[model samples]
Target: MSFIGIKKNITQKDTAEKYIGDVSTYISNNYSNNIKVHDIAKYVNITGAYLFRLFKEYLHTSPQQFLINFRMEKACELLKDCNFTTGQLARSIGYRDVLLFSKIFKKSFGISPSDYRKQL
Candidate 1:
């Protein structure tokens, strides 16, 4: 068989799993920055459409949702410490608008940042 055919012998499921892992790692490492699906797709040597489809199929989440969830989780962790203001915390977690961050935070945890900190 030719090289192309040989390479094609690899299962699509395996390739999708590997790509999803790579994208997950990329999101984990860069969650503090504004990352887009196209950027991740480029990093993994795939097209944006393919990346989206793979993420949806394997992770049941879009890349953007994954990033937002990651950021919110990080924000919750940081909220335990009282060093940063809400704005600073939001910015640190890749949110430029504190109000928007608060909205997302409230939606994710069902409480405001200040209240969450108070509980800690």
Candidate 2:
């Protein structure tokens, strides 16, 4: 008889949870650009692959997605009070391309940065 079983590994969801918390803390405390998946895994004592799997399994998203969302959310907050152009805003949020930032910002917020600021 042949049987199939699921792989058993990394059962402690708490580790992944801790990693998420640590990653968030690191992003908040350090520059947004510094929060890479490798750095996050190193900070949480996990391999990059393991951390990626953990985030996908529990959060249903990749670490990059989380970081991008976090950055965009912060940018939205700053947009309300700051008068920086889109290029400046992109740089402030660790985005190297103003065009790319605008595309992402528009997709996430349903408006470009300029439009968002005008609403504020």
Per-residue alpha-carbon lDDT of model 2 for 63-92, expressed as tens digits?
878878988988988898788888888888
Candidate closest to the true structure, highest lDDT: 1
lDDT of 1 at 44: 97
Per-residue lDDT, model 1, residue 101, is 94
Q: Could you tell me every candidate's TM-score relative to the true structure?
A: 0.83, 0.78
Model 1: lDDT to the true structure: 0.86
lDDT of 1 at 109: 88
User: Which ranges of candidate 2 are over 4 A from the true structure?
Assistant: 1-11
Query: What TM-score would candidate 1 get against the native?
Result: 0.83
Worst 10 residues of 2 by lDDT: 1-10
lDDT of candidate 1 over 13-101, digit per residue (tens): 78998998898899888877867777889999999888889878888988778878989889988987647999999989878889999
